[model samples]
Target chain A: MSLDNEQVQHIALLARLRLADDELGETVEKLSRIVDFVDQLAAAPTDDVVPMAHPLNAVQRLRPDAVTEPDDRDHLQQNAAAVSDGLYLVPKVIE
Target chain B: MKGQWEVVIGLEIHTQLATVSKIFSGAATAYGAAPNTQACLVDLGYPGTLPVLNREVVRMAAMFGLAVNATIAPRSVFARKNYFYPDLPKGYQISQYELPIVAGGELFIAGDDGAQKRIGITRAHLEEDAGKSIHEGFDRQSGIDLNRAGTPLLEIVSEPDLRSAREAVAYMRKIHSIVRYLGISDGNMQEGSFRCDANVSVRPRGQEKLGTRAELKNLNSFRFVERAINFEIERQIDVLEDGGEVVQETRLYDADRDETRSMRSKEEANDYRYFPDPDLLPVEIDAAWVEELRSALPELPDAKRERFVAQYELKPDDAEILTASRALADYYEAAVSAGSGAPQAVGNWVIGDLTGALNRDGLDIAESKVAAEQLAGLVDRIADNTISGKIAKEVFDAMWAGEGSADEIIAARGLKQITDTSAIEAIVDKVIAANPGQVAEYQAGKDKLIGFFVGQVMKETQGKANPGVVNQMLKAKLAG
Candidate 1:
């Protein structure tokens, strides 16, 4: 379950993060701890234990495939950092 | 140079519950809301903000369990699924582990070989949704939309009982239909309202041990899920045959490229350090609430399909398609009731012209321009010989454009059926007189010439003449 330096670097690149050289050593330690914890589950005797699907035996209730909500234009634009009329605005480069 | 192989496929589907509010908060579970507007501070996971479990979500999870014929636990716990994403404001998702709301149910999927195979329902649990991360929209940095952050979702995990892509898609469709029929999820794929992920692995035939499984994520459409799974299965098979091993990881489906690329290794449950959410209490439901929800459920898809076949005398194939959506089934029944004891005619109109119009206009059955009663009135006109089938089609087209009731449109456009015998007889007589050369030809033992006279009568009546009446009168005249 232990990960080497190269494997740690590869995982970081795959996850879309930038880590410092010092942080790499630290991440390796934390990640290994996490992996070791998950590995404990492999031995908890699942041979006779059926995986749980749902907690209850009731059928899932449904709603009419009806459109229940209206499009909220004002509410949609309320949190915009910038707004112009009905549209959202952001920084522009070329005119 | 060949070793035998067997493929083991399982599906993990995330179905959003049809609840009015988010799973843990009172924010309206509305899609397409303003970013972060639907989110409350609790959903943002602010310090000191406690999470409260929505009782309705638990009831929904329980109902889904019952529908799948799964077992229910008297007590279920929620745990935090730790993950880091911009859209996930909590930095972790509230999900189920160790104890889920429902467990050990199976869905019977129809196999291609005219038999059924039961896909084991490993677990069905209630969970809160993560916020949306919009990777597009004019920037390198992704925007975070939390409108869906607290929305309640029921994740149904299925065992790797599926053997083929077809079975996987069939299972998905059945689940989609069941949820829709139960009023659980809108099951809309376009808005990411109903989504699923697939786990695929391969093993040698007759082997009991499992293989390294790769999980495919963000499949928004049924077609993509099927294609992605099929492609992944084939890819794994190729890798194994070439002496390569399939690594366990999380894969992202690039729909544009139609391939699944490895994102990262799959995380185990403990990766999140799934501890019970301290803010929320464990969910508990009494028998009374369960019975109430059960009574409120409409006739599900399978029962409705059976009734359509038995009561309406529709073929199984036709009934399956018509009752696939509850809206269409309701529309069909309304039209039949309006037709007044003519179920077959009603079925034809709904399945044929009405559905065609709906598709052409890009509308769902519930959004059709023609009401069910209007369609009934139109069918009655045909039954009473007020209009021929050919003209009924024309009237249906007009009605679909919101031109009012069939009678109103017929009266306004003068498209009523020509049922008067004398009126039709006059056309027949005029045709007989005008076509003397052809009549002479008919009398010279051209007994098959009745169709010629019928055509003339139709032209004289401007295609409104009842073909039945016209043919009868023409036969008598030509015989003499």
Candidate 2:
């Protein structure tokens, strides 16, 4: 499948990315190439092969369900751009 | 409503697992923590962070699968569902996609007609919760609380087997009780421990193909789910009747307005590019572990209900109510075992008086002030004729008020039954003498006046007179 400029713009909007007027052409080219490269694998005849999820084919490691982390709001919130009442503040989000 | 259209409903219930920590992080999962206080570095999705699966979450998911008799996949994989929201700092949620932990189970719920209907469960998968975006607490800005982020959740999806809003609620309630009985969730709808999204659609009668479905999101209560489904069903039917196509979208249930409105159209749907998370591995459960967990499972509600009917000779309805909650079932058994030899009597008190009082006080059986032994004592007093059933209720009220034991309350208030023949005879004589006109009417074959004399004797003895003795003495006196 080929990606069009409109499709690329829609993807950008979904990703919450702001692109300059000049950046759109280059972005569409790069994303189309990536899509084409991935689409190439559709031609590989491997109907009987089992799909692999992980490279190492390893199962999940389990952790005990105990509260091992302590309350560190004061320290952790230091990374936030803005925080009030212990909550990270962002621009108003409509429903 | 019945013959014009048919409603097709499916439910996706998100049950927060009763885990101490988040699914992927070691952050505390306790509710009511200060904003962001329980969130840790791992939960914040800091760079170079990895998610480790919580074994308890997997165990809980497996437990639910077993509870519903679903197939537990020996191996399950976690995937990242990519999306963008301020509350989701990771820009994606860690959830199961292609391979979920549980698959293909059925829950039997009572239909509107009281017959059992089986609802198929499509899958139940483990996932990490998203944070809360507080849209109202700030001016021109929203607050993001990560406290709920990364919390363990088991999202159980059901096939569209429900036919009406009532059936959907029944199915939700059945799931709710099962999770609570498994001790896998607190099932607190108020706290969002158990929440569900309802997918609703409508079809013309005799139509085999399903109509377009509108998903109602985040209905946290049973009543809301039912009402939302009903409203959605009616809206769809109306739209179709007016030659309009029902649009597939996500809707929100405005419980205050008792209506559902479109939140987002299908055109605006997010394309969640789901892919296997390379950070986490596929979970593999050995048969030995499954067997061990199965053996440790408690007696489920159905089996307990059957046993109650078979062993205690309780009515099926009574047994159903008693076994609705594991704690109540255990309380009933304890009361019976605590020397309340009359099983039926004990079941009655537990189901009738005890449950009534508990509900009136907005308390659970575990939080009930009346202990099992105390209830047993009350039941035993009635069985042994120490106190009439009516007086036992008064004693029960006293016990609930923390007055004392059944014996203590009876002794303190002199509420014991006037089982002594002479004592009852004296009250009977006083009642007969006080109501001469009624007595004369009774002697003239006004047999219905026997009730009036019995009431007089009961009132004189403070409802402690042995009713049988009072009747016998009154009949003998009036007959002479």
Candidate 3:
């Protein structure tokens, strides 16, 4: 499960993180420790144990299958970082 | 060639739960909110913020388990899947791992033979969605929109039972309909409301061991999901044929190019460093709560389709299409209850004329101009001969145009059935007199001219003439 130095750098680049040159060696070490821990999970006795999908075993209870959640404009607008009256504010696209 | 290879295909479908509030907070789960506007302190990943599990989300996951006839664990744990992205303010996602909400269930989908194929459900766990990263701005940095950050999602994983791309789409659709039927998700792909991830690989025929699989990421549409899997399978087969191993990795489906490209190699569990979240308690669902949810469950699609067949004598295909959506089924039933006639007649009107008009206008059953009861009333008018079927079409057109009730439309337009035999006979006699040569030909043994007389009578009465009465009167005049 352990990744080499090159693999760690590749993962960080894919994730779009700007780690410093000094941080790469430490990151590689920390990630290696984490990988070793989950490798132990592979050895657990999963042969007899059915992989658990859900916590309960039974038929599902359902609603009337009608639309319940509706959008409320004024209230929804409360969370915006920028707004003008009722509309959201974004950087102008056109001159 | 290798000894034996088996393709293993599993799917993880992410469906947005139709809840009014976020899964972990009281913030509204409305889409299209301003960037960061919907983010409460907890959703924003502010310090010391703890997540409180939304009861509705847990119940929804349980309902999904019930629908698939799966095992629901009384106790499940939420683990933090750590990752870094600009949109993910929490830097880790709280999701179910070792113990998911539901397990060991089977979803029944339509196979190529049109028979039921039970696909094994690996797990369906509850999780919160990440925020959106808006890169449309002209800058090096993308803006983050946290409106969807804490929205509730049910991640349903399926065992690799699907053998082909067709089976993959069928499985996804079955899940979509169930979530929609349970009123859990809208299952709209265009809005990113429903999304899919597929794990695909290729194997030789009659193999046991699975091949190295590639995970295709976030295919929003059903077609994209199918195409992505098919393309990846081809890619893997070609790679193996070229003496290269099919590396285990996550791939992206480029819809624009209809191809899949490597995004990143598959991450081992250590990459995420999954750990049980400290702020959240182990989700312990009580039996009583499950029972309450079960009691509130509506008639599912299967049961409803069966009932439609048994009660209405509808064909299997007819029943399936009519009950595709709960709203459409409800509308069909309402029409049936409001009228007294054969179910087939009502079904024809509903599925044929009504559905056609609705589709033409890009409307669903719920958005139809005619209410269920109102439609039934119109059918009743037709069944009782208050209006001919031909005239009923006109009435229906008027109803579609926002004209009032069936009776009101009929009265306003004077489109009543013309069953007055005496009046029709007078018109028929007049037409027989006007066409002397044809009438004489009819009496001289060309009996087919009787149809010509009926047409003339119908024209005289402006199509209000009941064709049955016109036929009878025309026959009597020709015989005498």
lDDT top scorer: 2
Interface RMSD values for all candidates: 9.4, 1.4, 9.2
- For candidate 2, chain B by itself scores a TM value of 0.96
- Report the candidate with higher DockQ, 1 versus 2: 2
DockQ of 3: 0.09
Q: Is the docking of candidate 1 incorrect, acceptable, medium or high quality?
A: incorrect
Spell out the clash pairs found in candidate 2.
A60-B282
Native contact fraction per model: 0.00, 0.91, 0.00
Indicate the worst ten consecutive residues by lDDT in candidate 2 chain B.
Answer: B261-270
Residue runs of model 1 more than 4 Å from their true location after superposition? A1-95, B1-8, B137-140, B201-213, B237-245, B264-270, B421-460, B469-480
Q: Write the per-residue lDDT of candidate 3 for residues A1-95, one digit (tens) a residue.
A: 38777898877765667788899889989999999988899988888886443465332332232223343445655665665533345453221
Candidate 1 chain B, which ten residues in sequence have the lowest lDDT sum?
Answer: B264-273
For candidate 2, the docking band is medium
lDDT of candidate 1 over B1-480, digit per residue (tens) = 224766677888889898777777667777775566566666656677766666667767877877877877766777887766656766789988888988998877677575878889899988888875554565534555667887899999998898778898988888888888877888988877788899888888878999899888889899999889888988888888889988888889989998999875344322555777655555655677667766776787778889999999998878878888888899999888877677888888888888888888899887889999999999899888888898898899888887999999889988887888899998899899888888888889897788888888887877799998899998888778
Q: Assess every candidate by TM-score.
A: 0.77, 0.95, 0.76
lDDT: which is higher, 1 or 3? 3
List candidate 2 stretches off by more than 4 Å. Answer: A19-22, B265-267, B440-447
Docking quality (DockQ) of candidate 2: 0.78
* Chain B structural similarity (TM-score) per candidate: 0.86, 0.96, 0.84
- Per-residue lDDT of model 1, residues A1-95, tens digit only: 47777888876764458889989888898899898998899989889976443465332223332233344546645755754433334443221
Global lDDT of each candidate: 0.79, 0.90, 0.80
Which TM-score value belongs to model 1? 0.77
